[model samples]
Target: MRLIEGTYGIAVLHADFPDRIVVARNGSPVVLGIGEKEMFVASDIAALVAHTRQIVTLDDGEMATLKADDFRTYTTEGTRTTAEPTTVEWEAASYDMGGHDTYMHKEIHEQAEAVDRVLRGRIDDRFSTVHLGGLNLDAREARRIRRVKILGCGTSYHAGMIGAQMIEELARIPADAEPASEFRYRNAVVDPDTLYIAVSQSGETYDVLAAVQELKRKGARVLGVVNVVGSAIAREADGGIYVHAGPEVCVVSTKCFTNTTVAFALLALHLGRTRDLSVRDGRRIIEGLRRLPGQIAEIMEQEEEIKKLALEYAEARSMLFIGRVRGYPVAREASLKLKEVSYIHAEAYPASELKHGPLALIEPALPTVAIVPDDDLLEKNRAAMEEIKARSGRIVAVAHREQEKADHTVVVPKNEDELDPILLGIPLQLLAYHTALALGRDIDKPRNLAKSVTVE
Candidate 1:
């Protein structure tokens, strides 16, 4: 043990140890699953979920010795410790693909239901706001929050971008998101009145976990926006909102990303109500939130059409995704999903930025996917589409209505402008799925990527 350093989750057993096993974690995750007269230890709770739904998650610098019917938790100094077992809400079946061909496909189909779970019992129709009991912040404390900063990595980092925008727009607070790895290493200024949020699907992501720990040590208020309960980030943050994305088994995320966006919407609503957001606008946003599940279903009904579109675009050597404002993040996420699932080279840029440099890349062989919502930016995006058209670039438009300038159109349902990103991003999930299917790429297990990046 003296020779060990850095992050590790180790379990050892030997002939001399009989039925007992020793387990410890420094930087990785370890969950102790409790069963009938037996205990199971694993890096993730999913491994022992079928046997038991009760788990005790170990903290950093914690070690445990487990037997058939008993276990003890202790610190590195050898003092005994205790942690209460918490019930895992996710069923064992949730981790399975059910009858789907792959975990990715199953997760894409689960978005509507997953979103509903994150929103259940949180909507306040009477007051036109949201109830987030986990925040542990009263109205006064919430009002004192002057700025917001979000930290995450990869997909979670992209989600944080959207969350930052939402907080800035709705809550009237200046907000932004940065890569967790960079945030922790850059010696960022931590303010007492500024609120920080750490986002991670697994909650065990080492970079994000380290960022949360650093923020807390600096006496800064940090909240965790994570899916997994009892995950390291969840335990370390001062308070947070659970994304409630059930069990996501696919390496390429689908449902969890959607659920995290929905969770952010609720968080934004809560913050907005505490500030200057009027009750009328609050009710309007709440109504729009209620319509999201049905709107998602509407997008799913277009799978066959999107599959055909994917086949049409699959032969392209590369692709570009373009959007503006709220639509920009949608384009960024779509670009990522395609590259992750289809093994296709794709790039996303702000629609306005094309003229700056990306316009040179547009050609007949290079296709483009444009997100054109029916908002204030509609005219500007149309102008961008015209630029792509003039360059002879084939355009696949994901818009609220058909675009005459584009070669193909995938029309999505219209929602409130603030909520547009959530609905606009849904069709692209299917597009990426079908594109991968057309190319015979692995949908569930994409090469060189894991579901959760536990290590740096």
Candidate 2:
């Protein structure tokens, strides 16, 4: 017998013998499936759903030995235990790889269901509360949280930005977002009273992992908002809520981004209801949360229109994206997606900063994608749109309401003020995907990028 231990979670499997093998999990996820005279194991549930849904989810500090006929469970301390197998009801069609033309398009369309999946079984209807068991913070502790600091990289960082906003608006918590890569370099102050959240789709992103490790080393509590189960960050963090976005096959993120933002909403609702947020307000947010999946579907129906619109701007030499507050992160993420899949040169800036520098670049030759959420910033976003129009720049507006100034308008379904960003992001995703398709660029494997960034 070998003892495998680490500061974070670890999954080890011994396959030296054919008939029997040892599997153990610390912080990461390991699911076992029982069949007739055969058993299967994997870190991701998606990989096993096709074969069997009768799964036993191994908790932290648990081990299992699989033989030809049966499996036995034990604790890390070597005590024999019993783990019941649960039959899960999941659609096998969701995991079918070859159904769509490209993984990017397939994952893009999966957002509605992906967002719905993350919200499943989480909301309490009677109390209008959200329960996130992984948060490990009770109402009393939650009420006392001094602040929230979120960390992530690339797409995850954009999601974290939205998360920071949700926490501030819904939970009334002081919150901010920083890039995990930069956070690790600065030796940032680690406060025990503040909740630190590390966001990563893979949960194995090196920068996010390093940031979590450093925060843990400093005795600061850390939580993970991650997609992949049992990933390094998921194991290392004290506790966390999984995004449960399933497998994101596209190098450029689509479903994961939307789902992560929804996860933040759930977390925010959990924190908000725990504090001073009234049940009336909580129910409003809860209803808004429930409306997201349908709203995403409504936005998706504009695919043909978005495809035609993409063709109109596919020839642009460069592009600009602008928004304010909640919309800024959506623009940033949209710009990244455009650059990644379409290989277009794109820049994103807060709408208020247009005159600061980016506004000068607006001209007939360049295009700007503007996010116009129907919030207090609506007037400011309109002013920015007029500014871009003054420079003869072609404008493509994503808004809850029609914008007369926009050269083209993609109207998205409206939600609560705080949830508008989540809805607005979907249209931009379709824009990016369709633009890449129009340009004949490799949608799945864009020029030099990997799905997960494991290195610095």
Candidate 3:
């Protein structure tokens, strides 16, 4: 009331009546009855229905300027006020690619441009070096670092596992990937020089947050690799890099996972250079990174084949995923994607570890998904396929080239082992997405789950 009078440069008054009160603003008055000291004011009748069945919506850009025994009046741009109300409306077009039929199909088609956007401006094409200005570690400090700890959950955790291998092999740095939930509870050593990197799509994951807080308490240098801007983890970390993959509405993440992996690969190569790793070797890896998006696009063209394979195995209640070495992490992610969306029971095992255990679970009713890239492990994975066949387990293989060894195969274009994960990951994601659709499961919001787990 005071603000209104002040703005209009007019004296306003209030008077008590038997069943109501008379209020005046800029010499115009409005009368409203009181019930338990509650007074309602709104811009529209719809907003006042709950408060009182009787209401009057003020006219646009007008103040309720007068109050009297039975009525009120309003006026626009009062004596001394110049403010005006403005209405704004916004609409967004659907990402749906007209009846190509599924979101997974549209997303699969978007991979090439998505990956390209994630890699843009961060690399120098002429020199093949990563430009991460926020990585504050100098050469001497990087060399002094003896251990690395990566913390995350779900798919991000699997990415961390793969990152551990890259860090160890390229930077020659001993690295460990810990499930953030477990890492927080376990007794661990951390110091000022120790580097702890946290990966999260939302940067507010409960377990990841807890682990980062614990590491900070122990005085470790913390870094965040996240997709969201100004998220909790990003604000808490000493320095960080944004994945810049944009908003991923799907509950099962697609582009963000590959983008995060690309960022980690770059970070690993950067650390390698800092620690005096061979320039020739680092450039070769960078060259592979540059070509990754196109390779993934080529692989994505096989979505129809992947969909057919998913349909073939849709009736199976249980599935097993197997991989060796770096592929083990890919296997873990594949299993997670399947279980998350399709509600199918799925498990991932290191192919080499099958003989020790997992082999006991294979049977005719279960389908096996193997990540069989054309590498040293191809024969080993084929051997595992043979075992699954011996047990009569239906086989669905994701390989670099088509193979007759399995009941079904979704082939990807071949690349080095390091780059194979990026190419091979797409079809598995598509498979899970389409399978979920076929089962009529919610693809964007799975039951009993939040996009980011923010509480411990």
Minimal lDDT window, size 10, model 2: 1-10
Q: In candidate 1, where is summed lDDT lowest over 10 consecutive residues? A: 1-10
lDDT ranking of the models: 1, 2, 3
lDDT tens per residue, model 1, 28-69: 898899889999999998798899999999999999999999
Could you tell me how far off, in angstroms, the CA of residue 172 lies in candidate 1 after the best superposition? 0.9
Lowest lDDT 10-residue stretch of candidate 3: 84-93
Per-residue error for 210 in candidate 1, Å, reads 0.5
- Report the number of the highest-TM-score candidate: 1
Report the lDDT of model 2 for residue 210.
Answer: 80
Q: What is the TM-score of each candidate against the true structure?
A: 0.99, 0.84, 0.77
Number of clashing residue pairs, candidate 1: 0
* lDDT (tens digit, per residue) of candidate 3 on 170-235: 788889788998888878777665689999987767678768877888788999988765555775
Q: Candidates ranked by TM-score, best first? A: 1, 2, 3
Candidate 3 whole-model C-alpha lDDT, 0 to 1: 0.72
Stretches > 4 Å off in candidate 1: none
* Better-scoring candidate (TM-score), 1 or 3: 1
